[model samples]
Target: MSSTLAGAFGIAALFVAVLALVFAVQALRAQSGTAKAVTELAATPEPQQQAQAQAQPEAKPGTVKSELRRLSRELEEARTELRETLQHLAVVRYDAYGEMSGRLSWSMALLDDNGDGVVLTSINSRNDARSYAKEVKAFESDAKLSPEEEEAIDTLRKEASPTLGNPDHQ
Candidate 1:
């Protein structure tokens, strides 16, 4: 009986030890996660946070609301500027005529967020070179576009799309 009781006690102790080890490991993981979060928070300068906090008390609800509103306004302004700015551009080079062997002729498309801009084309040959400009609206031109001019606009459309992650489009 005594041996049996002793064995049971030993088994209970082992169980407790394993439980403690598991708890210790969980605690360490939690601590590591907390430390990482704190480090990330500290990476930002205190002055900037303080500047934001200075506008109102750190604990005030109004301050947080005001800051959010200001940030929202700034973001809208930036987006507006980005849309109005000339952000899309492309150039297409091709042979102007079948007789022209060299790809000396070229077309360039420049556009804004609304696809309002101009396409410039320069046709070159042995005899003479001619350049012309056409207005582009909503990615389409009022004047008839040559194949090269259309290709230039298509290139700009592909490049200017947000999925391209082109900084110039931004």
Candidate 2:
């Protein structure tokens, strides 16, 4: 009976050892799979970088320098175009006539970086309304500017001054 009990205990110990070995093997395989996935991710490029790489093929050193120069030129051209656009603007509203109280009359100045654009004025009176447009060059107009029109242009210039804290307005 003692020998039989010893034999049963040995079989139970063997079964537990086999179960532990199986679990260890499974854990090692899982760790190896995780390592392989991390390696694959490291080898892949970011989406934006991949797009840029695809758009521009590998080039010689000289070709790469020339591409950079071309890009710089395009950027400068875009900046020049933006400066030429009418981006600076101001409006002055006042009562054109003494009897008028609502201040419906307005003078608007629309200029670019170089102060080349137009000034538009609308005069409202009790009896009638009149509108006019005059071309502006270098913040001056060929036609005589009304006081309100000059005030509008002056407002834009004052706002664009470096002292006012906006150098981009220039």
Candidate 3:
């Protein structure tokens, strides 16, 4: 009877150990899932998080509103200045002379958002090169434009539109 009781106690101890092992595995799995969730949350960017990440100094309530208004004005001024910048550009290369086969001559158009800028052309020959600049206003030039120069301007206009047609169409 003593030996039988000892064997029964041994079986109960084994059962308890198995139960503990199962619970430990479940807890580890739960902890890993929580860790992954935390990592994902940190990786995602929210506006508030970005502001905090920038480490901007805290401002008084009234000052914050005034600062935002000043920033808004500055942003508008930057946008207006950008419109006047010559950001649109295109180039056309062709053989200007019948004897020149390498197509080294080229015409380039540099324009702003308002289609105001200049077209520069370079005519290349074996012995010499000639360069010219024509002022453009509203995509048109007071001076006569060569075919290559006109093509360069047209290319920039087409590129500015989604349909690759007239920019005014949309």
lDDT of every model, 2 decimals? 0.77, 0.79, 0.78
Higher-TM-score candidate of 1 and 2: 2
Model 3 stretches astray by more than 4 angstroms: 1-62, 162-170
Q: Write the per-residue lDDT of candidate 3 for residues 104-151, one digit (tens) a residue.
A: 999999998777899999999989999999998888899999999999
Which run of 10 residues does model 2 get worst, by summed lDDT?
A: 161-170
Q: How accurate is candidate 1 locally (lDDT)?
A: 0.77
Of the two candidates 1 and 3, the one with more favorable TM-score, higher being better, is: 3
Could you say which candidate leads in lDDT? 2
lDDT of 1 at 35: 66
How much is the lDDT of residue 113 in candidate 2? Answer: 76
Q: What is the lDDT, from 0 to 100, of the residue 83 in candidate 3?
A: 73
Deviation from native of the Cα of residue 149 in model 1, angstroms: 0.8
Better of 1 and 3 by lDDT: 3
RMSD of 2: 16.5
Mind giving the per-residue lDDT tens digits that candidate 2 earns over 85-166?
Answer: 7888899999999999988999999998777899999999999999999999878899999999999999977775652223
Tens digits of lDDT, candidate 1, 18-73 = 99999999999877866674564356465665565466554445543444445645
Candidate 2 structure lDDT: 0.79
